[model samples]
Target: MKKIKGALALLAVLSLAGCGAGSPSSGTAESSPEGTSGSGAATALEKVEVGVIPIVDVAPIYLGVKEGIFEKEGLDVKLTLAQGGAAIVPAIMSEQMDFGFSNVTSMIVARSKSLPLKMVAPGGSSTGDTKADFASVMTKPDSGIKEIKDLVGKKVAVNTLNNISDSTISEAVKLAGGDYKKVHFVEMGFPDMTAQLAAGNVDAMAAVEPFVTISEADGNVPIFSNYAEPVDDLTVAVYFTSDDYIKKNPETAAKFARAMTESQKFADENPEKAKAVLPDYTSLEPEVIEKLTMPRYYTEVNEASIEKIAEISLDRGLIEKIPDLTALLPSK
Candidate 1:
């Protein structure tokens, strides 16, 4: 592990501007300035910035910062929060961010198009326990969307089109005897889904935490747990970096992977500690944080889980073909 002086100060300032308390929209990438690398090993430490979505699944990254996990690895980590992988992936490709937290579906699509991205570590995953809800399709109690079958011919909102939500929901709908092709999906941010559903703008919305917790608290009824039917114990998201970063800074990438691995293990074993750091990085209330369904965080990149997602993406025509999974992940 290597340490660089003065980098923590910059991280502290970015943390406030990007992930200030009670301000969700403030965490977007506009708040993080592009990092400049100096010369030598110290330069790598100073230039380490990770782009993440402001969601509960990424809690371990915040916890790692607070718990000195990244610091112990001799890396000063600047957290850049973005609304979606669509934004983060482009930044990564442009060399604006060293690493990014992204869903596997999006990364698969990116690799399929020869985007030069590689998964360095696991991000978050489903528990596969039907009782433990990480993501779901929900609607207003009065919306009459009692089952997955009801979603057909309705405008269901998803955070993204032709990604995880679209693929999973389509499979779930099919499993429930619904015509998956007839279901219409509209792209909407998670933060706006609840409001849109309430206003009768969308019949149902696929939501992940803490929106799921927030919507449930607001009396919305969940039609089905998105991870339950289509794929159980799914690897939802992963931490990735551009191929250039790995080639130029292998040591830095390895240190980051090790630190994140420790953080993921800590998060998995100590849910309360992981939850404790949420308020520092997200706009979710403390009460809501306590109630939100936590995603399973793991260290080792699961090839099988990723292959399943890629297979689904291929089936849905989201990607022209399944990209080589072995090359997409770093050799451990």
Candidate 2:
């Protein structure tokens, strides 16, 4: 509880500084679930809605709906795009969304706050490739920042403070024999981070895919893969729902999980298909979309990675206790 309050206090200070966390304010593009409308079988399908962000991590779900995988499971999944997980969590809690896709760190924080959310599927993972992962610790050329350990005593830009950026980066630094507590974190949206990096406002920026690729195009060098180190093939994010919602609709949840697992398998096997459907839901240009780094779509979550994140969260004082994975994670 003390740690949660400290995080909220930090949020207040950051919000007053003009650079803060991204909230859900913009309208989302609505995509039709396969066989939900066109085939005159809409009535037979179980209408489902999920909150998502317009990023490379969500390609599997989009591809699943596109390839009729969800339809085959008797579920009609509608995706609603939000600015970030901050918005999606609320939507799920309020019954506006049936499920949501969010990073494990944020979900852990939510669970620590006693929010009755539960992970239902493995949503995103790192490729375990330092040079070509979905996200990286990006620094400008000749910045003297070459690795995660060097980031100690330097200012790092994260979309949100006290979240995964601090967790993963600190862990990598600790593994490299550096002091994790010496690192400084600042809050700014991803869209604004690259410019800040170029201007030398931040020493290093936790850059995610699309941004990592875009920043690299502008000559910024990657120090290391942010989601890869400390644990290779780390689970970066997850698909989840309100605990109450799951309890009331176990069958629906099971069907969604089965369909999503199939979706992950399909995306894992056909990486091009994942890229091909990006333009259908996002506003990114063809050229940029073509070069975006995609995350691993695994049907199973890396429990060790999740546990490591929980321990880091406890260390960061983001949570008073490590969350109970058995209760929060999907059944194996």
Candidate 3:
């Protein structure tokens, strides 16, 4: 009876082993029952490090993080603040982050450098109606600066060189018969633009979103919003991850995308819900957020729009050339 019981126990062990209930074959790593392989499980629980520039343009991702949507997608997300869109690509290349929010201009330049940055989501775009989303070259309400033509040889504040703000300002200047080269471009953070303009450090600034709204509140007025001009369709904001990260962990990336897309839908369908959640992730005051005009959230990246930005940059000498976008983007 003892011999028979021992034999039965051995059979049971063998059954479990064949069913992957026991340790993996010595030659192969074991996968958790929760997933297909050890790598698959690892991917699911992967810690996602996301980088963002603090601006209302990126509110959907903020809302996603604040709402725990990434958590719901089996990702542990960490956010790092970047100085501007231009800084985000280098952060991704150095592996300082797995994902980041950046503008199309920077993304194009990075792509031209073969940075391995893949744009996974669209962040925002310009509209014809307002400067509430993107930057507009502005002066004091009573500065008597009626048009972009007035900016020639005057100090202009921009968040960065060769970015959306500068590009928009250049276009606006051309339309107003001002030479962009004559306008002195000053690099300043959005928050500092108004103060600098007020303090007489800058004659005008191309400011975005809440900054534009805040400047208006402070009696600073825009000469022209980018939306009012005919310019290339540029991506105002986008989400990216390294190609290596995506290839190694497709499921994890997909999960992240699903969560972000859902959040975009939520923000689109429920503006008040977005207003309620903005303060949880952004520095914008609730009242300021309430007063701000937000952009429509879009989940999918538009390839044509991205290409247009690259084309514009190339035309405007922001980038020497456009990169092969195939590898840096998902299958359409």
Number of clashing pairs per prediction, in order: 1, 0, 0
- Number of the candidate with higher TM-score, 1 or 3: 1
Whole-model alpha-carbon lDDT for candidate 1:
0.76
Q: List, residue by residue over 1-332, the lDDT tens digit for candidate 2.
A: 23322322322221111111332234444335445445666547788988877677788999998888888888877888676788788889999999988889888888888898999999879999988888888998889987778999998998877788767888889989999889988878776777788788999898776667667777789999878887767898889998999889999999999999999999989999999987766555666667778899999998888888898889879899987778888876
User: Model 3 Cα displacement at 197 (Å)?
Assistant: 1.4
All models: lDDT? 0.76, 0.79, 0.64
Residue 210, model 3: lDDT of 57
- Candidate 1 vs 2: which has more lDDT: 2
Error of 3 at 98 (Å): 1.6
Top lDDT model: 2
Rank by lDDT, highest first.
2, 1, 3
lDDT of 1 by residue, 49-153 (tens): 788866677888888877778877777888886655767888898989899888888889889999899999888888787556778788998887888888999
Better TM-score candidate (2, 3)? 2
Candidate 3 TM-score, C-alpha based: 0.78
lDDT at 217, model 2: 71
Task: Give model 1's TM-score versus the native structure.
Answer: 0.84
Q: Arrange candidates by TM-score, highest first: which order?
A: 2, 1, 3
Candidate 1 Cα errors over 4 Å, as ranges: 1-47
Please estimate how well model 3 matches the true structure, expressed as its whole-model Cα lDDT: 0.64
Tens digits of per-residue lDDT, candidate 3, 1-332, equal 23322322322211110001111111111112122344554345457777765556656776776676776676676766555555556667777777877766766777788677787777765654544444566798777678767888888887676766676677667766778778788876555666788898999987666566667667677687763354544446677888887888788778877877887877767777777765544445554566676666766666776666566677778878788878665555
Flag clash pairs in model 3: none
